[model samples]
Target: MTKEIWLNLPVKDVEASKAFFTAIGFTPKPDQSAPGERACFQAGKSIIMLFPDATLKQFNGGLGVNDTSTTSQMMISFDAETKEEIDELADKVKKAGGNVFSEPSEVQGWMYGFAFADLDGHRWNGLYMDFSKMK
Candidate 1:
């Protein structure tokens, strides 16, 4: 069984990427820092790696960067403890120079969520589930 997992993503700027993740409550793993290659951040059990675009190109055999304006491969989701927390995070992301894609909204009468994009245009969704309202 796998004990842990890490998600690797490519970005144009490492410092900006780090700042964005920090604002979203991810902590950097100091041991993983290196020169001109990769940076790692941890959010609870999830690990997100930000690699430079050139490194990512080399790693994937020279694949071109995705056109984020037209398509997104995935949106990272974080679970919030409450609806207020979700809203608070949305505000923080914006204040940290990110963009909020959605205001908090109810879903299926049970969950509330919002969406934001990081400095590098990576989209993230934060959700709060009301389990007590589940049928």
Candidate 2:
């Protein structure tokens, strides 16, 4: 059985990426990170690992990594506790130099959230779902 999962992402700068995530409320794991080579952060119960492009290429069998700025292979979504939390994160993302591509708004009358592209152009969606409104 899988007890733990880690999301590995490629970044241009490990320290910069670490700073960006930290600014947006992600808890950095210094003990698990290698300075200038890799960074680890805790996002809720998931572990997010950021590695430089060269390092990630080696991990992915030397395949070319997609240019997230132009093409997206996937979008990671996070569940927020409330609409206010989504809004707060959106603001923090903007302040941290991330692009808020999607403004906070209602979705399907039950979920509210916004999307943003991190410093590495990785797209992330923060959503708050109202279970009470579910059919």
Candidate 3:
């Protein structure tokens, strides 16, 4: 009965993180109840919810989140319609104050992408895959 999925992430600053995502073209989902404490964005068919560090810890039952600076938690991938889109996103991420860990490059002659870390160090990558190049 699962109709949709949402990703809840911990952020050091909701406002800054929201701005970063917005700069990279993620559509914001307005929620007046939480104000500066939370932010939500629509990434394709999924929803990404960002909460202040302490707020997310409370929601996680005090388990806390990873220290992204030293830990590799996960890589969230975004599908691009073309290779140019991937390149464009990488540039946007860098301009938005994100760390572009991996420069845009071809992968196996079929996929092209680049990885970046958000201001809070959450890893993400935008990829464009050409199925026709696959055997």
List the candidates' TM-scores in order: 0.91, 0.97, 0.95
Per-residue lDDT tens digits for candidate 3, residues 1-135, read 776678999988899899999999999988622667889988999999999888888988899799999997899988999889898999999999999999999988899999999999999988999999976
Model 2 per-residue lDDT tens digits across residues 1-135: 877689999999999999999999999999999989999999988999999999999999989888986799999998999889999999999999999999999999899989999999999999999989876
Give the per-residue lDDT digits (tens) of candidate 1, residues 36-113: 567888877888889998888888888987767777989988798899998888888988998898888998899999
Which ten contiguous residues of candidate 1 have the minimum total lDDT?
Answer: 30-39
What candidate 3 gets wrong by more than 4 Å, as runs, is: none
Clashing pairs in 2: none
The list of candidate 2 runs beyond 4 A from truth reads: none
TM-score of 3: 0.95
Alpha-carbon RMSD to native, per candidate: 1.5, 0.8, 1.2
Off by over 4 Å in 1: none
lDDT at position 74, candidate 3: 92
